[model samples]
Target chain A: MAESRHLGDIILKIDHISLSFGGIKALVDISFQVRRGEFLAIIGPNGAGKSSMLNVINGVYHPQTGTVTYKGETRHHMPPHRAAELGIGRTFQNIALFKGMTVLDNIKTGRSLKIKPNFLMNAIWFGPARREELEHRRKVEEIIDFLRLEDIRRTPVGMLPYGLQKRVELGRALAAEPDLLLLDEPMAGMNIEEKQAMCRFALDVNDEFGTTVVLIEHDMGVVMDISDRVVVLDYGRKIADGTPDEVRQNPEVIKAYLGVGH
Target chain B: MIYRETGQYKSNYGADEQIFPIRQDRIGVMIILALAYLVVPFIGNDYWFSAILIPFLVLSLAAIGLNLLTGYAGQLSLGSAGFMAVGAFAAYNFMLRIEGMPFLLGFILAGLSAAAVGIVFGLPSLRVKGFYLAAATLASQFFIEWVLTKFPWFTNYSASGVITAQKMVLFGYAFDTPVSRYVLTLVIVTLLALVAKNLVRTRTGRDWMAIRDMDVAAEVIGIPMLKTKLLAFAISSFYLGVAGALWAYCYLGTVEPQAFELTRSFQLLFIIIIGGMGTIVGAFFGAAFIVFFPIFLNLFTSTVFAGQLDPGMLSHLEQFVFGSLIIFFLIVEPLGLARLWQLGKQKLRLWPFPH
Candidate 1:
């Protein structure tokens, strides 16, 4: 717990990253450093490669150029599972949840790396397997309570409302206890109240769990309020990167958000 | 009224996490066990054992195997009979070649051999899925049957290509009697079904389901796609293999490669689809339905028609009725009999009040 509170070192560094799909470039020369416990927001117009950037960070997309450094280990390309193993967790822009699974089971899957898998032990439900399952069940229960998903704990995720599904996805990501949590449009399509709730959860996760956050959001007000720093992207290029106040005052950020003068 | 769980408060996680958490369910399972172990052996004649119970039990085990891959892992397989054949022939070979090899040990070895073949065939699942994967797995069915039929060595130089299974003996006690063999099958099936139940509630089961539901999210969440898929195949194949061995030694009393044809694989697929995919109990439900429905049709026709129809026409009628019923069940209740059972339990919980 103490280890999570004291945060200073750069946990994730996306240095000079350039990703392209054939003729089109999704991201060009995108460089940023995320410190531990920082709430960083990436805000941009539609088609600004916001999701593609998150995909890059979580190793879903291997950029054609530049290296990703995490916990001092640098790599040109990493698989998504490898990123997950290195304490990086992400939710999809389109809400990628296990639709068939119950809320508890979905969250329990987040604790996959915590326990060693043994076929025989699991088959008998004895010794370490049983104990570890109970132990993680307790942990997952705590997450369910934290997310206020107690009533629908046994409900299949596909049956839940979109907002609740988003919360459950957050719970699933939090269950991993990742050092870096990437949330893509967590508050998208939600009402004002649901957006407020999501914002509170995001801030609480940043403050309480000391989890470094890289959020891709379009809500300028929400992004400006909760984020410690904002990185603005336009047409796959980083326009401005600084604190909200500094970036808001910057002429280029304004032109990007508004439009270029005739 | 008796199916409720009003006062069953679980003080511990262990208690809450049981396979059958409800007291009524636990008692129901106990009763079923009692009937299967104590009552059935005495009451069931040879016809019942031969025509219904043994085949049901064996197919149920195979259904569980298919469920693990298709139901849980989202990998469509069409080679269950091939795996079963591998087990039957492998068990035969083990007992034949190794001096003084116990039949039970040979069954285990047969399962392991099938698991190995399962992994080899399962390699394509990583790159392909759904119908494509099903087509890929079909190779195992044809390849295994060909190997068994073409090679004389598998049958130990038998000209007929159908080998008589070795006698079942444990500690010099011959399981020659129908009741004894039924008991053995029941014990093995029960233990294995429980193991399957336990497995589905744990880490391995979760991983398979995760892959099934969403591979991308599963990968992002650190569930390795290759390892989980292959493990599902291996375990599922292992179960099918044992079921095959049981089919040969206990049910059929003869091993023939042709016995595990492509149609048998489809039969196993139907069992899971109609039983309820992704459930251990659904396998039993499906197997029971498959084994009993045809008999029920025949009985109904005989009683209603009263010898008016010819035997050939009656047989065709039975097939037609069976096919229609399967289609009806699929359209009416796609989740299978297990979901229907769950709905019934839900209704029972709200009974007396009409809620």
Candidate 2:
């Protein structure tokens, strides 16, 4: 697994993108390139527009300027579902699992694009629809097993602990079989043990699936430990971008973290 | 004890994903189907057929329709009766205009017509939600009623705008008697209900539910909001249309625009609320409650009072009691009757064990 973990050509290129809400700028001319099969971390203080950057990547937000090139196709604006169809899947900062549904069903929902729907076939639950449902169920069960959520397979996601819910959200994104996985503070509110488990899962996802991962985190230790590259954002602009060691040595990033007046 | 699934094991995902995955549930459903098809026809009388069963089944279908939209898809609609009226009138026109058109074919056509209207009305849901969306749908109810009443063509130039439904003829067989009508309703309702059950478990159903639970997350996750919302409206109206056709042909034998009024839409809404939103069985439970509760109240009141209370006052008393009970049930179980049923089954499965 370690030998196979090699970064290839650039998969996602964010051009000089600028985004604003009325008068408040969320992102200002922020640019970055994510190589194929690499774990990239975006770190920032509160309101640093980390989540907004993820949103832009997944097409939840359209920047006023610049294009997102994914798998060689560049687009100024893409719908969220179209982005998902193009193999970009994301989890929210807040746990966004379908609360009413069981864990199994929630994961299965990630496979929405995979299932070619036939209304009549689905209504009857026969032939191709039935077979497809079984097939997807198998895949979802595998995800459940992979995430060690077998005990809670039938449990409603709302009933789970915050850490477990975040894990399940990751499981849901993984179920989508995405080429690019975007995680927004997945370890937020988790204990040290849960954080370690989450980090392990993230590493496994990158190593085994060879999927490109973009993570937003505030934990400096976790970021320095896991990420191949780190992009530090302060006040809607990229301050530093390099390997974790190089980013740590950069005075600009230290000033952003340690504060200007202090 | 009877609901136990201790020994039953699903070897595959296919077995596990069944609508009734538990053996006991499968058996229970089979028994219910057997009773409905084999036993009910022989035992039920004309009053039972017309007054209770037929309306209950039809309304259950309509409730299921509304449940799919409001309950599953989270789109509040106030135009269910209007869609039903479309079905009733469309069926009427199909039978009248076409030479020798089959009743089943006419019903399907009526459903399609209602579906079209439902789509048009459902457009507003894309922009608004909650009370605003409900208000938007109310326009469909008033507008549909106005169109049906304003035009003499819908009523075939009838002065009162009341359209007597054409004879329900199949492939050379007429469903004339109460038992026959009841059977027809039971079959259609059961089929549609099963179809509904299947739908709610499939990907389509999950997408609707995802939208309902959280639209922003749902959209971000790639569930197309426009297509999903519109499909919910169209399918919901299709079911409502069929139910309306059944109401005209089998239950009432005649329907005017007044019959499918705003009050009727409220009744349908009440059924889903009382029965349990988002559950197919909840629709049936709600329909049964709505249909039988009043009659039960009347029976209890009349027998207990024995003409001591005036009929007019007694009816008012019944309404008071009914309203209170509805509020009580809602307060007791906001998830509705289906949840109660689920809890009961859960308790039964763990009988005599504290854990």
Candidate 3:
């Protein structure tokens, strides 16, 4: 499953990315590469532009200066849906499960980019639409099985505890069957046990689906444990990028981030 | 014991995704259908059909349409009755101007015309949200009524501004009697409601609910908000439009712009709020509550007062009671009567084992 070794080409490359809001810069000359089939963690203090970087990668924000190259091809002004259809899936910094929907329905919506059910067929729900629905439902159910969400498949996500809500958000991202999964603060606000579960699932997703994961997290335990490499951000600039041990020992990183025990 | 489905299990996704997944629910629906189709036409009196059942069925359909947009999609729409007016007039115009145009085609075309108008009004939703979108839709309600009234040709220039719908013929049979009209209304509502039920459980329905929950997240996840929101508006309007046509042609047998006034719009809004937002069955419960509450109040006040109280005072009392009840339901069970129905079903599922 390539768990021990990340021996693949660079899959996503961001070059000289610079973004500013009015007079303030959110990201300045932040450059990094995400290797194929690897877990990459971005860690920083508050206002570190970690989320903004992920947003840029997903086409939610167009950086003032940058070229996002994926799979050796430079990106264009593709809409978010087109980017999602191109196999880029992400969960929100805060849990974004549809409040009124059941866990199963929320995950099924993750398959929206891939489904081909036309308006009329969806309205009637017979023949091809039914077949497509079953096919997608089967996929979603398998994800439900994978994430251990079988018990609460029919429960509205808003009613669930915070930990379960984050799990459902992860399940939705996984439902897209994406090549690159971006998780923003997936383990935030979770207890140790829930944090452990989320890390295990993140690793399992990389191992089983061979999905390359890029995550923004404040939990150094998780970032250092599962991440193959770490990128540290402070004040919209990348201070250090290396293996966890290397970044942990770097003098500048220690002074800037680890000095405050972040 | 009849409520239980302990031994039976769904074998596949298709079977599992069945609208009434529980075997007991399937049977319950069948029993209700059997009663509606066979019993009502024969046993129900004319007063029951004309005064109670026809309006109930039509308004229920209208409620479902509004629920689709407002409840399921989280798009506030106050122009539902206006869309209904569009449908009624569109059908009337189609019937009047065309030679030998079938009533069925007229109905479909009317719904389509409403859908068109609905999309036009829904365009503002791309730029606005929440209460602003609602205000835009509210404008449609007044705008449509104004156009229908000012242009007397919509009513065929009748002095009284009423255009009586000719015999509602289906397969050459005239649906003129109260019983026949009730049957037609019932059949149409049932079929549309069934289609809506099927819709909400599927991908398209999920998209609408997705936008309703969080539009930004929905867009980031690849749901095209513009497409989804407008489609919600279009489909919701189509349902309301069809209901409007039924109200005029089947219930009133006439087209009058006043029939679908702004008050009618508010009535539809109240239907979804009290019925349970985002539920197909909630539409019926809400409509029933809205339609029957006034009648119940009138009867109760009349019997209690025994004609001693002034009718105006009694009417005011009825309004106060109705307003208070709406507030009570909203505060207590904000999900509405549909939520209550669900709770009842859940309780029934575990009956004989109290805990």
Model number with the top DockQ = 1
Q: Which DockQ-derived CAPRI band holds candidate 3?
A: medium
Per-residue alpha-carbon lDDT of model 1 for A68-162, expressed as tens digits?
99999999988898899999989988989999999999999998988685878999999999999999999999999888999999999999999
Query: Clash totals for all models, in order?
Result: 0, 0, 0
Over the stretch B269-341, how does candidate 2's per-residue lDDT look in tens digits?
9999988989999999999999999999999999998679999999999999999999999999999999999
Q: What is the TM-score (0 to 1) of candidate 3? A: 0.97
What are the per-model C-alpha RMSD values against the true structure? 1.8, 1.2, 1.9
Residues B1-355, model 3: lDDT tens digits: 4687788887888778898888889988999999999998999999989999999999999999999999999999889989999999999899889988999889999999999999999999999899998999999999999998898988889998888886678688988899999998898999999899988988889999999998877987899988998999999999998998999888988768888988999999999999999999999999999989889888899899967888889888889999999999899899899999999888887897977
- The residue ranges of model 3 lying beyond 4 angstroms of the native Cα positions read A1-3, A76-78, A258-262
TM-score of chain A, cand. 2: 0.97
Native interface contacts kept by each candidate, as a fraction: 0.84, 0.68, 0.79
Off by over 4 Å in 1: A1-7
Docking class for model 1 is high
- For candidate 1, write residues B1-355 as lDDT tens digits: 9889999999999998999999999999999999999999999999998778999999999999999999999999999999999999999999999999999999999999999999999999999989999999999999999999999999998989998889989998999988889899999999999999999999999989999999999999999888899999999999999999999999999878999999999999999999999999999999999999888888999899767988899889889989998889888899999999999999999897886
Tell me the TM-score of each prediction against the true structure. 0.98, 0.99, 0.97
iRMSD, per candidate, in listed order:
0.8, 0.9, 1.0
Q: Please list the residue runs of candidate 2 whose C-alpha ends up more than 4 Å from where it truly belongs after superposition.
A: A1-4
